[model samples]
Target chain A: MKARVYVTLKPSVFDPQGKTITDALQSIGYAGVEDVRQGKYFELELATTTPEATRSMAADIADKLLANPVIESYRVEVV
Target chain B: MRFGIVVFPGSNCDHDAYHAAKHVLGQEAELLWHKDRDLKGSDCIILPGGFAHGDYLRTGAIARFSPIMQSVKEFAAAGGPVLGICNGFQVLLEAGFLPGAMLRNRSVRFQCEHVFVRVEQTDTPFTLACTRGQVLKIPIAHGEGNYFAAPGVIEQLERERRVIFRYVNASAEAVESANPNGSIAAIGGICNEERNVVALMPHPERACELALGSSDGLVIFESVIQAIRSGRCAATLRHAQGRPEPSRGASPPAAALVQ
Candidate 1:
């Protein structure tokens, strides 16, 4: 099974990269964009036989390694 | 006292730390490889700056799982003194030894320059040699050096006076403009409740030599050495001094103090 982990900075934390992207977008006449927040995505290929097990393992990885709980939150999607 | 400088695969500043400890401070120092489980009975352990484990997945995230970090964690749990500088600071945070995380600089660009940091608390083993409110001119080089923590954690650190250093101006004012990386509270460094574990964004080891433009960073190294030589745990030195009065007299520049 395969899993995808989405990690994002907490809403309250400032995202400098996102802000710079927003500025570049505005400069390029993409005025409809109000703001941008950056994040990370990780795809893991698991050898588990069941989707349930893959999801659980993915969540564990996200919590323990993929995301820093202090500044980031993560979601796991098993596919 | 003996110092151990942990050298991870990508660690570039391990030699600088070793040189600072062994040559500059005239103390015994060794480079401990990341794979080594033993710390060789070091009095203090340092995690020097570099893109450990190539900073993959996140800075310090992968390096935190190295074989030696297990020993480092155990050492810290036993109240051993640990100083994490720059990338080492990130590793400490990632390994759950410290209370915060690093974010990219506010400018979203790599910044390498000399900045002033004021000693906020003088009780830690890392800052015992520094006077309270003394500003040290140190060089910081990083792209992801902005420090962040939960508001409650920040409050607790403030209330307990665990904050060791704050970005400040030449006049020692910690204003927003003086903050180089947009860290919360302008925090440049902090210590744990026991005050043995410290994490900072600046490169104190690099600034230890006079040729490095400033020797301000030596005070921190000297402070650790002094604490170890006093035959007391760094945390207890404050109580040993009768409730920890701040050092008096105007703070001298690092050049003058070192000479």
Candidate 2:
């Protein structure tokens, strides 16, 4: 199975890279931008045998590899 | 006193911390690799400062899952003394062993320079060797050193006296301007409520020798030694009574007398 994981900093946390990008976009004449929050997306190909197993396995990957529980939250989508 | 320093793939200050333990305190210290499961019977463990795993994805985001971290977490849970400096501090936060998180500097820059820190509370093994309000000069070099927690969390930390150090300018024998990173309320370091684990942005081991331009960091290690010996004694006593190794979630009463 193939899966995609999206990891983002919690809403209450600050995102400097996102802010910088937002500023650059504004300077380049892009308007109507309110805020930007940076995040990481991971594409994973796994052969976990079963779909039910894939969900548990994906959650494990999220906790162990894809995200840091303290600041970043992650979601996984199976393909 | 046996001490161990964990070496992650990109860690830069592991040797500095090991040398501080060996040269300053004249004690033998070991370096444990990130993939190693054994801590090797060390009384204390340290996660040194550096851009571990390149601080990718997040400051210490990847390193938190290293094999050695599981052992480190077990060590801390077993009432062993643990200290994390700078990037190590970030790893501790990512590991959920410490409260709060590290964000980019308020100015959005990777700050690297000498900074002053005031000892806010000494009820922990890390700061018990220093007098309350004492100031020390140490260097900080990190992109994500600013400490962040919700206002309610900050108030709880204050009420519990968990704040360990705050940035200050103690160079002129006075607390001057703030340091390289603009941390929340100028915080440079903090200890868990149990006070056995400490995480700080400043590199104390880097400042332990005069050739390093300061020896202020020596006392920090000394405090750990004192706490370990005392804790071992308590652990032994508690073991005799068949009690679960006294909780590591609060400061030992004797810690208050350390200062």
Which candidate gets the maximum TM-score versus the true structure?
1
Model 2 lDDT per residue over A1-79, tens place: 8777889989977787788888988888888787889898988788887777777788898888677665679888877
Clashing pairs in 1: none
For candidate 1, write residues B67-107 as lDDT tens digits: 99998887787667899999999999999888989999998
lDDT of each: 0.88, 0.80
| Candidate 1 residue runs with Cα over 4 Å from true position | B234-259
Q: How far in Å is the alpha carbon of B250 misplaced in model 1? A: 31
Where is model 2 more than 4 Å wrong at Cα?
A: A48-60, B171-179, B229-259
DockQ of 1: 0.87
**TM-score of each model, paired residue for residue:** 0.91, 0.83
The TM-score of candidate 1 is 0.91
Expressed as tens digits, the lDDT of each residue in B103-214 for candidate 2 is: 7776688887888888988878788888998988888888888788888888888888888888876542323256566566777888887777898998999999888888
Error of 2 at B44 (Å): 1.5
Query: Which pairs clash (backbone N, Cα, C closer than 3 Å) in model 2?
Result: none
Docking class of 1: high
